[model samples]
Target chain A: MPSVKENTIVTTAAAVELRGLRKSYGEVVALANLDLSIEPGELIALLGPSGCGKTTALRTLAGFETTDEGKVLVDGDDITRLPANKRDMGMVFQAYSLFPNMTVLDNVSFGLRIRKANSAERTRRATELLELVGLPEHAARFPHQLSGGQQQRIALARALAIQPRVLLLDEPLSALDALVRVQLRDEIRRVQTELGITTLFVTHDQSEALSIADRVGVMYQGKLEQLAAPAELYSRPATAFVAEFVGTMNRLPGLMNGGTVTVAGRSLPVDGTAPASGSEVDVLVRPEAITLRPAEDGGGLIIATTFLGSVTRVRARLADGIEVSADLPSHQASALTAGTHVTLELDEQPVLVAAPLPR
Target chain B: MAQPVTARLGRGAAWAAFAAYFLVPMGASIYFTLFDRDNHFSATPYTGLFQASGFVPALQMSVEMGVLTVVVLLALLLPAMVTIQLSMPRLRPIVETLCTMPLVIPPIAFVAGIIALQTRLSDADPYGPLSQLVNNQLMQTGLPLLLVFSYVVLALPFAYRALDAGLRLLPLRTLVDAARGLGASWPTVLLRVIMPNLRTAILNAAILTLALVLGEFTLATLLGFTPFPVWIVTSGGDHAQQSTAASIVSLLVTWGGLLILSVFGDRRRTA
Candidate 1:
């Protein structure tokens, strides 16, 4: 029932590598000796905070920023010296980047028009991209007439219409409504996968990176903290920054020994590289790994409970005056009240531990 | 919320004041142009403009200079503005200070500086070919072409303001990057994307340049050339009635031209 062109790939797979990129603005370093490689047809999301250099890395790859010392290689071609227009890449920008004067159809066909594609061919490819993004009916409309989500969809179509070797997305969904953002992010992933294009998506939103990217690269202070699969990055962070930034981590005071950290009378195996033996450390635990139970002699008291659809997060204060939050099934947490005393237990998952910080 | 009756009356009075200030002199001029000394209707003031010597040529020269000045303004300011916004944003404050500098300088002082430069260049022989090129090629072009370059400076504040406001409305760097990533060369991006998107700004700036050039008199008169305004004053010393008609016609034509340009920019952009 599908068309003949649906199964064929339009964009060729490209291996993108950024090696030793070093950029600075006066005294501030935006990127410092940064290196990243994306395999053919893979989606890599660079995740970080506002000044973390993730967007700078993406812009460097797109040839927008001239690195003080680095090489940008696409399919083994050193393109660090190449101009952006000659790089033959596609970039979906963060803002409403559609040309205001051009119609949606014209915007999509812009690349084709620049390449001197004839009318019929340009229209065919543009129409194909529009249909791919599911907006064939809005081609005649201007960008201002479409909703923010729709305009971004057209932007995506325009990026892909040229069959670019690698696609660069610079926080393309940060301005949209929450519901629309999720929807558009899913569509972007779907279309990128369907075309088998190598993509680098940059964002400060950890959830967005975790949900769509094949591998997430966490950046901090102009340096790469860690790069790994979403589950691995979440479950076994290489650095304490990555561990704390990706998701909520409850740091409980615990003692570290070779392969384990003991917290609340229980010793759990360390998830990542274990710290020195017999050292004072702060053990990291996810909210979901904590189990709760009612006990007459319990040293913990439930302070608050927040419902999050199928699950609930319960905040409790320990005998040591440390607060810990546990994610429990909403059905079971409904029975617990603020005045109740509860005992906490850890699921057998390996825990990450960091050095104790000065109070 | 509805305004109170007293507040409404106050607003109405303010509007009446502005309307009276704008329309009263215009009404008097219209009455003067349409009547003769005998208190009967006549079109001589309007018709006599055609009979004036060098009227058409002076008007033609002003239009030409206006168009050329606008062309130069766009060619000079747009690239500088885009480059500042996209590449070297740190230079923005400095560039803005430089561009809006004409506003602080009086026209008389600016024209005096130009006259000094012209006098110096006219007698230059030690600089060799450069001086020869300036003295022979440029100085010989008469007033129409020489005035364009000076008018561009005087018109910079207005034109730059228009273009800067328009560029502010756009995510200029993003649009340029998007275009370049799509395989558009620099000229293609400028002509196709940035320029088309800037139609309203271009039109607005062009109109401002035209208005300035068509109404400017000091520089043209001091330079010993008779552009439209200079010709209007020189010829008006003898023909009092037609001078009033000429001033009114210039105002009306500038308004009409600006309206047409606004409509053209808006309609074409939306269409």
Candidate 2:
């Protein structure tokens, strides 16, 4: 284990600092000038689809991959040229990569053994770590003897055994089933908080990122679209891609006339600057942000209805044959079947508006 | 349960055939050595058994040379196999071909060439550097180098295959990565993980080398080296009783070595 000064502030410490990080493989650019700064004692989730450079960033920080350009500073020191072993960073692989030949205790104490810790102290620490991961009785079993979830937990404990400054997780829960994933996610969060270790979690699941991260960075096309608190990101997306990727957004192709937008043959009030008149633009509205009401005299009809326990989603077709999806509270939802006459009400202001692309 | 008569008759015939295959040779050899009417245990024909002659010296020389051959073969082959596998994965076929080359070359043909060269050089200038080195050190060391070279040639196939199988079974990448991630240097990783994981391979190859060393006679005879098999052959033709005794002794030694190898050679590689 590394020794830290007693007078240093632990929480506000910046453990990982990446500046102009760039990596590419032949003709494909994996990471194009990625810059990210992570603070100590904070769990930041890197959420993106496959090939979005999330894993590349984590590997760079762990010193597993070399940066084509720029530097990686850890604990206020540049580690651009250091090897992975000397980086003192704990990493949990996507596959529960436990050493299959060793028992759980030995796997957990591998780092300590390499550091030449005493036998008694190493055993005691390893046992405590196993107990911390809720596997106190499984210390004697080999990795193959355990289930997938148990193996992941053991991998986690083995990573934490070294007490590293930063914990890097590469989709650690992706291999487990849904129920075990949720269970292990909570346990990982709890352990992270208990240990107060700076961790970078990479995942493709939006809900998992939104639920577990203190602040989530939404990545797309090798660049971060937005990095903010989860609530802020969901409530106010920074870009059109962020809005569509982070949550469900019904983008309505519309025309900007003066300060108001016309979409689906209906005029909606805009809260932001409207594009030039007659310019093609897209009007973004979330499902829950729009409201539906029974309007028999109106020109729209409900084409489909999906009941989701708490809220009912209604897909209504306008007079111009464009479909608009809106969510209604279950209690306030009308008993409107498919192909029933209805009307949408613009019940909320501050609607997100974006410019449309050229045809 | 009731048995069929035809099956019983077939089984009895199979047993008779098996008995004739293995037991007849032992019976004939024992009969020839102990109760042959031609020699009748006469002291005159048993002149080779006298310790004052060349028999004891040859026996001692063969035992010493066989042990040295086994040791040198193992020492040279283990590290060579490991280094070739670790450093040059692409050259594996070439290395394997070289390791197995001795199997295809006839021992007599190989030793014939060696003897031809040695005689040519010895006649040209016995006091030259090459002749002096060979005669002074290699030949005069009781043919130790020749015996060791013979053992290596005979044992290469077994050693290479065993170590190659071990290398395949070992989780080399995981072990190397684990050691490196724990701040261990390359030498430490090789010593701690690589060597220990190859224990079974080394033991199996050692036992195989020992067997080949003890049983090899063609190469030893061609090279004029005193290996156990050559000694046994010389002793056998001299006196039937002493030759049977030496055969039993060699058989016991081979069996003991195999027993030790089997006992300790069962190992599972760990990452």
Candidate 3:
């Protein structure tokens, strides 16, 4: 594994910058003052649910979506007014827009052909790209002749053929089956790494964003809720939305006082500003963060258990019916049966707290 | 699972009915053209077709008119189509509505309107808008501009629909963005990426437009033009057999062009 230092050096040159970006269509605002800085050669995933504007943000960078306000700077040059065709950025669409009329080689070589590269060079480079994507054997086949995964790979190779300064992927894997999605995700990361191209990947899959991206930005309703490394995002999500979205979180209703939150008849230390004492708050704890043991006196009853290969996910309910989940090793899980009572140990570290829901 | 015999029989009866209705009329037309009342099959019409000198002039005029209609309409429509497509997305609905308006207005009414407008405009200025320099000289030469303009108006519905479908089916955003990003000017993108992708649609529309131009009647007649359709109609009373021969020849030519277009279009798409 490459060290974090190597990754940082490769990705920290400020490749693209978005400042106070805003876009609206009629009454619905798609992106609102989105500010982001992508480092050169970095692969950053913009993760969000549908309509969160992650795709919109990627399009804005690609110059497909015009920004109503704010400047988009690429390598310190403002390109906000630049037309999409002049942006010189490469993009792989979610639909894998490999030209159906062209063969895989022709599709991959389209950018070079458009730029008027010498025919020999175009063919040579296209062949290299097809090989890079592991589809050199399929070059003669038209787009319809290939599988969805193969088509997307060709799309990626085509985008890269231009040697674009920035690569934009808009939900590139969302259209693929699960197994192929994972396979292609890894392949994309490998290719991006090998080429050291600055890439902005948009996806709604948290696991994809975390596993493949050097950093993940969680977008919510056209605003970025948090942007951080995968571990930080999962372990220390910046907001309740981030915490719940990045991972499965069991939230407990609580009251905040100073740096502590009172939940389920127990007081726990928390970070960040707390509302006035007795004010409602939401305390989030990850399933893995909570430890469980068979309760001697039947305190916590197992309501549900899901075996997840190496680990077991236990959905338990307290006597008061507060549902909480715990992740235990497979061996530990095997010892516990349905209806088994368990004791809980919440991680000592503080969890994220947000304003409580109203009745 | 195999289809039931009853279903198969039902389908066979439907096909028989279809043959009786469609093939029967066509077969009768061919029979009438080939055989006389005595039921003797003679190649008289086919033999007479070669000696038919009426087709020479008519064929030349039809080809000239069709080519002129296509070149002029494409020169007018392509830019308009590109402009409408790449314009502000908000204005798309309005542009689309305007483009489709010609379809709703009947061709006869459209030609009438064009003639009336041309007369009104020409009367207001004897040189006919650009007539000042040349005066009545240009008008005397018989400009087919207005005639072709009417044809374009008639053809706009199919042309616009085809072009719109082409633009919609294309990965337009990526194409535009890729071009612009690469520092290609708007003109370059319009000429390069947009035009290449639109070849099939443009060809199909142009072929259909050519067919429309070749077969058009009311507009050419109203405008006092000697185009094929008007000639064919006027020739009908003088020689019914000659008119039938002309119609068959024109149909074959038109069908040939359509066949070529369909084959090429299919190949281009699948290639």
Candidate 4:
């Protein structure tokens, strides 16, 4: 049986840094003074909406785009002005970037051939990459003959064949369906971890970013709002945008006081910076942090229930005409049905609070 | 169940009609070429092509013009089209308009404009550099380069449609970026990556240009040149049987060549 290469070349990874990156197209700025630094062998996911400059940052680092003012450094060497062909980066696009005219083997070995590797060496390396990607018998098939997922795997193998300086993924999984997307993402993560290559993954899917990245950078309006560990980013967002964008956050009216906020007669410390005291704020609470129980005299009435595999979501309306949603274990939520009166209990986790909207 | 009998009959009728429309003229041409003056079967008209005056030279001239037109057209249009689609996308409509302008104006009008310009230039300065360049070098060459230029324009609508369809089937920007990121230079990317994928489309363009160049009569004749079509028409005055036979032979040759090429292209693609 063909197997993964016994000796995959292990090269030392480089630290990548982007400083004061600025880009604008006529009136609209695509990237502001954005700056980022990545440690060697680390994978950072840039997460944002479309046109939020995540892709622009990745492209600029790949030397595909010229920034108005910026410096791209790899291991402290400035490479901002290098052409894409000279950057030695490997990229997997959204999908369908495979050269349709080439067989899978030819596609994989193309980079090595460009570097003037000998024939046997190219074939052996290409075969190893194909084996690494778990499609050992597919070397002779053209790209169009493969399934979409298979095509992407071959594309991944092609990218890694050269052991490129850095790996850049530009929404590579967005073209796939949900099941294939998750599977390929896990495959990508495993391969990236095994290779110990520095990577920049740009995606609009928050779950994809949160599940696979060492750190996730949230961007908005051409700015990096925050870059933090996935857990920290989800639990304690630096901005309201980050809080709402990363995960589902239920907004409840609260009164801010010093470093704490009061919501529905209960008090909790703020997750990040709190607004000035004695002002109304929007308290962002995670669904998992809220507990619900049936009580006739409770202040909230159960309005609906939704089954989500092991977790069930319960929506309730308070006496003051505010609605809240909570996610709880399915066993615990069996009794929480529509028209049941429930008393809500908040966990001890600090809650993020956003400034109140203008009246 | 198999296809319905009525549906089969409808398909049969469609094929019969198509065959009749396509084969009637072919059969008639064969009949005309095979019969001699004594009403006996002979291959003289077909074999007599080699002996016919102006036949070989006109054929050679047309073939040369067709080959040059395909080369120059592809060289100019491929990079230009790719650039317009990739970086200068905002200029797409302008380029498309310029490429397809020949389709709007009559070929006669286009040739008239060319001839008028040459006339005006030659009249203004009989021995000037501009007149000499236009008259002697460009038009009066051993085989006129002007016909090749005109054929490229005449074939534009067809070549553009072919190439555009092929390009639409591709994720052009993504492929280019991926190839560049893999360390292929721009020329390497174009030749090895993009052009190879465009093989069938390019052949389609080349065939269209060849057909246009070989069959074009108005531009060559109006500009005072006698290419294949003009020779064919002029030969009809003295040698009508040979002229008709040559038409049939040329049609068969073109179709046979295209069939071979398509088969060859398909084998390469599958391999």
> Evaluated with DockQ, which candidate comes out highest?
1
> Cα deviation in Å at residue A51, candidate 3?
1.9
Return the interface RMSD of the candidates, in order shown, one decimal each: 0.9, 3.5, 3.1, 1.0
The fnat score for candidate 1 comes to: 0.92
Rank all candidate structures by their TM-score, best first, as comma-separated numbers: 4, 1, 3, 2
Q: What is the TM-score of chain B in candidate 1?
A: 0.92
**lDDT of each residue in A8-98, candidate 2, tens digit only:** 2132224788888889978778788888888888899999889999999988888778989989998879999998888777788886567
Per-model RMSD to reference: 2.3, 6.8, 4.3, 2.3
**Which regions of candidate 2 fall more than 4 Å away from where they truly are?**
A1-14, A256-261, A265-285, A290-308, A312-328, A331-359, B1-179, B190-271
- Lowest summed lDDT window (length 10), candidate 3 chain A: A3-12
Which model is ahead, 2 or 3, in terms of lDDT? 3
How do the residues A1-359 of candidate 3 rate in per-residue lDDT, one tens digit apiece? 33223322222233899899999988888898999998888989999889988988998888877888989999999999877766778788887576655678877777777788998988888887877888888989988888999989998888888888898898889889999999999999988988788999999998899999999999997888899999988988888888888889987788887779877667888866667787888788899988878977968898888999999998898876788988989899887788888887787777778876553
How does candidate 1 score on lDDT? 0.88
Better of 1 and 4 by DockQ: 1
Please give the range of 10 consecutive residues that has the lowest summed lDDT in model 3 chain B. Answer: B132-141
Tens-digit per-residue lDDT, B1-271, candidate 3: 9999999999999999999997787676667777767888776665676566555565566676677777777778777766666666767788678767877987678767766765655563655546433333323324466666566777877887888888888877666665565546777667766777788888877887888888888777776766677767787786565566567767877888788888987877777
Model 1, residue A332: distance off in Å is 3.1
